[model samples]
Target: MFLLSFPSLIPLLRAGLDLDCAESWIEEKGRPLRDFLSEYSKAAVEQGKLRESDIDNALRNQYMTLMRLGYFDNIPRYASLNETDICTDEHRSLAHDGARQGIVLLKNDGNLLPLDPEKILAVAVHGPHARAPEKVMDGDYTGPPCRYVTPRQGISKHVKISHRANTTIYLGGINLHIEREGNDREDLLLPKNQTEEILHFAKASQNPIILVILSGGGIDVSFAHKHPKIGAILWAGYPGGEGGNAIADVIFGRYNPGGRLPLTWFKNKYIQQIPMTSMEFRPVPEKGYPGRTYKFYDGPEVLYPFGYGLSYTKFHYETSTDGTSVTLPATGGHCKGLSYKPSVATTPSCQAVDVAGHACTETVSFNISVINGGGRGGAHVVLVYTAPPPEVAQAPIKQVAAFRRVFVPATSTATVPFTLNVCKAFGIVERTAYTVVPSGVSKVLVENGDSSSSVSFPVKIDFSV
Candidate 1:
């Protein structure tokens, strides 16, 4: 972090950057953190950049931080950390779990998954990215792993590293180049038409296709999602070292997928009008800036909405609500710890509720039951999305208020409880002051994999009248 203290890197550091974007991408042998700190001082003095006292202060703070982190302590926690501490069962399990749960089941058309090993016989896997996870990338910031689980280790020699389950399993995705940091990506789709390549194979093979995607962000998969030949699709993301095992477990029905997409996979045409440079948070219809995220973005319906995913087994939800609507009285005197700048408008008004203060207490709550509709007993995630107050000009179309995951048996129900604060959940940001949870009706929609149910919530402010 000594590099962060450099006057030249101040702008970048302020933008939440680390040493990665700093001028020193590498330090050939003798140049360690302290050496770099000294070098920065020399440059500052010679170039008349930073004052001597300022340089000294920065150096002092960095050194103090290192010391506090135990650099000079009698017993540093990392003093003897060796290779043995690297890949333990705990570490491997964490990696495996992350990859497993992060794997989003993008599509499982016609109930083509939870592959019936007894009937399907074998999975004919073939894809550009069907090899071991380490081969794609291992320890992106560090060295190689102690070991990695591969298809050869998991399956037999004949059942090689290829994608196309259901007899045809096609695995394809991106690498460290998710248009990541330093360099940028020009195209939304992969370097090659990996979809076309899969389609070609799908036509040649007799069986249906199962496409596994590995990438940091979503690309245009409208073709595959709608294709009659491609029956199942899974997005593994950058699953890490234990990714192979996780993929296998999902494919073979050993593990049930309850993971959801981390982002809204908008189609490629989205950028045609919506420039990447557009940083405007809200949509301006007069200006034609479409806005962004599942929160805003009006037209050009996304290929998959944020938090969209499927489970091996289907689910239906039933909610326990307080009838049609319930009114909440906002009469709690002066909301204890709340503070905000008064609205610049002459007629300024706001609900005196601090986000932190309300976050600690439950203002409203409801219960939801998740029932597994499919024959297979598996886990399901019940997503609760709340429609924001339409009165607010710059409000989201909908916001994910709460979510709960439950392991329900086949054809059985599991009740999931959700709590939310009306002021925090349905409130709108009008300028810098008033956080108006405008008194009116806001809708709360709960969804399982297949269907959704809505709950009406009408809030009334006791003090407003």
Candidate 2:
């Protein structure tokens, strides 16, 4: 999991950070890395900063992990990693499946997707990403893929999307040039030229055009969402090697896009008002600061909210709440006058609790039924969010307490059973330690696709302890 990107220790390593692994520096730096590490470690140990045992443990852990990965074997895994071993049929299939799961159908007004080949004859493809997999198909770390399927190549085979007249597919997103390891995006809007180009094409065109954004982060695509000509939109993220094939499959109805957006798509002005370096999570209206994430941000309406996605088929969600409230246990010395006589927390003031303890077993359960009304069978993600009482300052507007994915057959229903531990699910944090505060007005919201259901319930914690 760890890749040594740097040969020098000065930048990354500080006093307490022990380097368990380092790249070969002799070839570039004219000295072995161990020489510098030995001197530094000796000084650290003598200064009572680091213990010899700590150094041994760190190296031991690193070696154990490497050994488990077959690093010390006579025939290590990489030794046999030939071209044939790298991108096999299985690997390609996995890459395709991953891309299918990640590609989000952002908008599908008037059911404008699932292009039927029999209905359509030809199409227009624009933007640089449509032709090749130069940047959008790859991210931070990558190797030459066995094959690359551009959007043009993928969509070219099955051209028909809808009966709603002439179609144009615009692929304009961004690459690593926008955001990466050391880089921060200056804005969320697609470049002015790209927006102008989309608008220009849209103006001359008819009713239904498709726009596909292929970036890792959120982009402000309010124009296309509201534009009458733009009928459908997709966020293909940095779809990997098999990206084109997956996209074509989704468009042609060979595969249904069941993936949901992992982030909120804020407007261009949101990033302009908020600094890139801002780390505040909660919103403070008095200071004119909107929050961040689905949990906290109170900024202007996001172009697309978190967990937003449109499916080719409609899904119905029905929740059967087990109980409105769950009772926590009192245990240890902390249990004094709590409801159950035992404590949910192992420490004073209920900072943390033992989940396996007697008090934490009982949870608020919800049985969610996902019924696929459409003829097509596809995957659906069930997101459960819990909102603490407004009185709790640190508590988010809503938090994703739990979630599950279920594949309901066509015209069938699948029940997703989700539970939340009374103590942990409702806790609020202030700096280092968390404080448990149960609210009678707490609400749990269960959402799937475009439909959402909610139930108001209270989590009873033995806070008296």
Candidate 3:
């Protein structure tokens, strides 16, 4: 991961050094946040709240505070910090930087994105949740203060002008912090008022209205169900201080805004509707279960599903060799007994190799090509999966093995071979059979969505040999 920090470094140095992208890459990738931090840092020095040497010291303190927030559990990159108190600049930057990456672009039919601000006439922003939380609203913001740019504030940078003017940008979604019960929202839908706001703007806007939602979870946009006039819908999430600005940049073609949801944004569903606790659990519908995610949920549904996002540009993918052979890596023996590396065993041709003892070869390789088939540049990820044999006493249906991301320039193509071995393929089955079966061929496939069309290859296994 650290190696990703200095992306400009030579490939060989990274390969030899086994270097990872430094955590600072978060700072590097987030230019707006960094600039905010730099300016805020300077402000602190002038205010006598801190000194030149205090920058690092303050970061350490904020790191600790972040860790204790429990938000770090979901976000591990922030775990490395040891500081407890933080400077306002650093704290605000951290929030903005983290939220920026979490933004997801749900759909962009034919790449109708990266809107041109100069061309746009108006933008209308609304949402019960658009403004800061009530706590933030009522509290005394004594520190450097919680500076934030709302979707409305952010969008203003690119567009000409309009609050009640010509064009419009609708910004609002579910208020997560607002409590309906002792527990927060279990149902992922736009709050009642927020949904109205979306529809209200859709009707009110004279020019093409851009819909943007600042939410922590997914919401039902079915109201916009095939609505013709509404131009774009952006799942901005809880983007922090610079969120408004970053979103504005993305809207008006300043940034490509290549982001996808990390979680499922259901049209109408909740966690209980899905099976997480019991594999043996049967599907129940009358209990308001509409199936969960791309796994069991049938098609033509979902406002947006996981891995769903769009870019200003479009992308296409191609594959070369459909066959594969796997090779095992050197790993501690104890881990081997716990988890199996299927990359070393499963091949496109349905072959399985044993990954138990020493490093072995059952190398499976797939040549994948990506093309920027649209107007601009975009990134694509090749997700590889292993299917279980036709009959398994108790086995997962499929397991993700290998994934690769590539940036394709407009009207250009790039091809890279993805290799997967044993370890990458399977998870540990505690107190279960550890033996390898050699007779049947294992199915390997490459796809995007869980059910997205993919090319598959078969392999031959030789466990006894």
Candidate 4:
């Protein structure tokens, strides 16, 4: 039998009873509101007081509001509304797109990544969540689909994987909701025996093991070093539906992983002195904190640095200019001397350099080149700047004046030209009793990534003032 079926009852309960108590009573009194709306809507329609479409809209709005308030799971209702098609193409696309976007490039020393699937033998896939499905959209705990792709399944498409096999590839990690929501992880270890399993495989296996972490954030895997046999590790976060396929593609050298880390992975939780625990915002001044990331951080070297990613190839960087001194052709446009020993571009004039002279009136060109010696194609970053000693500018340990990314093929090289502007160059911050001013220096530098670490070359220009 229908009871007090009133739309306004929700507001009355909200105002009078605690949310928790109200939810319990509402669940116990469910049919009342539904019955009232159905009957009232029918009467209104019959009397022409309200249109049928209006009633439908009101009901849809009420349902959605309840869904948002954690009062219901409306998936079944939505599923039926869209033409009884149990499975939609959008669900499949979401899975694929999610997986592809979650691939993270952590490290690539000696270009050991994008595994050669053809040469692979037996692979070992181990991890609690490796085959587990993510939590349902409504936060229900559902086991993995029977037809799921674990690391073994995904990689097997390209190469043979083993339970007692040759190479071992471990894919496992905690899900995102664990650390982000359901009360942040108490420890930084890879969840659910994943760390122990990886270590066990690395020790027992004779062939190289690839450890892939399927997570949304970093985890402390100090044990990683103990498993030197684990040749490579890739952080493949909770990739959407296509994640399994993408993981396989990367392993088989089908896709070159070019993604860089958006966060630093520490050795463990203890090492992450300032963990992101508090959701509240705290304002820190610019230049307020130093050595936070790879550069200025006073802590131990991280497992991986931010902006760190690997390719299947290697690049050798050489600059024609020095930190204390830099050179560019007087004519301006592109500089010629900015180059590498063995580069991708043939014509020196294809690139440019710039130089400045006294009274801050100079312009010139700079050229840079790079060579790929690895067996695969990848990209290289060329950074240029005019820098002083760290004590001199109190500037960023290294100031990047200009930069470029040059793509190179295996066993090939390329050259790029950059022009330097005088007004941009000869400015120095002179500190008086209180303020800093733009003064002149006798020299400027053009170098690679770090100014202090790179060799210095003289740029011919007059800066005496």
Per model, state how many residue pairs clash: 12, 6, 49, 39
Candidate 3: stretches off by over 4 Å: 1-101, 109-112, 132-147, 178-182, 269-301, 325-363, 393-397, 426-439, 448-455, 459-461
Candidate achieving the largest lDDT: 2
Give the higher-lDDT candidate: 1 or 4: 1
After superposing candidate 2, which stretches have Cα over 4 Å from the reference? 1-16, 19-65, 76-78, 160-165, 333-359, 435-441, 451-465
How well does model 3 score by local distance difference test? Answer: 0.55
TM-score for all models, in order of appearance: 0.80, 0.80, 0.62, 0.53
What are the candidates' C-alpha RMSDs?
A: 5.6, 6.4, 15.0, 15.0
Candidate 2's TM-score reads 0.80
- Compared with the true structure, what per-residue lDDT tens digits does model 2 show for residues 361-396? 556766878889898898888888877655444457
lDDT of 1 by residue, 258-351 (tens): 8887688888887775667777766867878788888888876778888888887777776657434434334444232222324422221443
What lDDT score belongs to each candidate, Candidate 1 first? 0.66, 0.71, 0.55, 0.52
Alpha carbon deviation, residue 103, candidate 1 (Å):
1.2
- C-alpha lDDT of residue 327 in model 1: 41
Q: Which tens-of-lDDT digit does each residue in 47-105 have in candidate 3?
A: 76555555655566667777788765866556655434443567766766555555566
